[model samples]
Target: MRADARKNREHLLAVAGAAIGEQGVDVSLRDIARRADVGLATLLRHFPTREALLDALLRTSFDGMAVRAAGLEASGEPGEALVSWLRDCVVWTTEYRGVTVLMAAAIEDPGSALHASCVTLRAAGARLLVRAQAAGVARGDIDGADLFALVAALAWLGDQPSLAPRADRLFGVVASAILTGAGGGDVEGAPPSGRG
Candidate 1:
């Protein structure tokens, strides 16, 4: 890329990151272009679609999440590392409004630009999970896919206006169940039943 073009792309990415972080993924592309002092045509030339823009914007964040997961695993107890990482995943996924939904779709769609990044992030979580389960802290049956789904679900729930207030509590309950084996059976599906 030419120096001027690269500069424009970087500026656009920075402005878009801040706008989406504050307002959401739904923030207008025109608004982003205006904020970056670039024309709509320039923005379109740089990012042909909303998904492309978002994929570029979030790539660094996803890489950071993977790095953090590795650091957590190295420093903390296996189970605690997994739990702590999951909490961070929730925060990371919801940093931009609608990011969690985008991530979920990206993970399922092989053609999505974000799919590779999402897979790397999930693999990071899976590494911690494998360690936890081997240490006899996490449930044996659950896998990386399960952990990824749980993190995405928590992030989605955390983003909802009605559920935001209770999201922390929900995380606690779910984390406890995953860590302590208090609730028997699959952690990925339904909540455990109350004893009579």
Candidate 2:
């Protein structure tokens, strides 16, 4: 692409990411075009579909998470690294209000433009999970699919306005449950002791 065309595409991507973060994935493409000061045709030329735009917008974050997971696995304790990455995954998935739901659906549909990115994201988490499990820190019964659902559930909880304040506590409880040995003490749903 020409320099000007590349500039226009980058501008559109920046504006679109902001718009989606604020207004959600359902935000209008026309509105994004307007906000970016680009024509609808230009937006279309750059991103042929809404899914394509979303894929572009989220690809970097997913890639970053994968790299972060690899680094954590290399440097940190297995259990701590998994918990830390799970927290990051919650933040990433809930950064945009409605993006969590879109990601959940996209991961299930191979035809979705975001499927490849979602798969990569899940694989990253799965790698950490395997390490933790191999270290006898995580439950052996659980697998990548369970971890994916756990992340989505935490993201959904974080998305709700009323529940947002408790998201961190809830995340901790879930993480504890996953890490606790089989037949260990029951996991409490409430916030851990000493935390508000």
Best candidate, TM-score: 2
**lDDT (10s digit) by residue, model 2, range 1-196:** 8998888888999999889878878999999999998789989999999999999989999999999999998988888788888888887878766887888899999999999999998999999999989988888899887898898888888777788787777887788888856422443343221111
Residues 1-196, model 1: lDDT tens digits: 9998888888999999989977888999999999988789999999999999998899998999999998998888887788878887877777788887888889999999999999999999999999888888888888999999998888777778777776777777788778854332333422211110
lDDT of candidate model 2 versus the reference: 0.84
**lDDT at 174 for candidate 1?**
80
Candidate 1's error at 56, in angstroms?
A: 1.0
Q: Can you give the lDDT of residue 148 in candidate 2?
A: 89
Per-candidate Cα lDDT values, in order, are 0.83, 0.84
Worst 10 residues of 2 by lDDT: 187-196
TM-score per candidate: 0.87, 0.90
Tell me how candidate 1 scores on lDDT: 0.83
Clashing pairs in 2: none
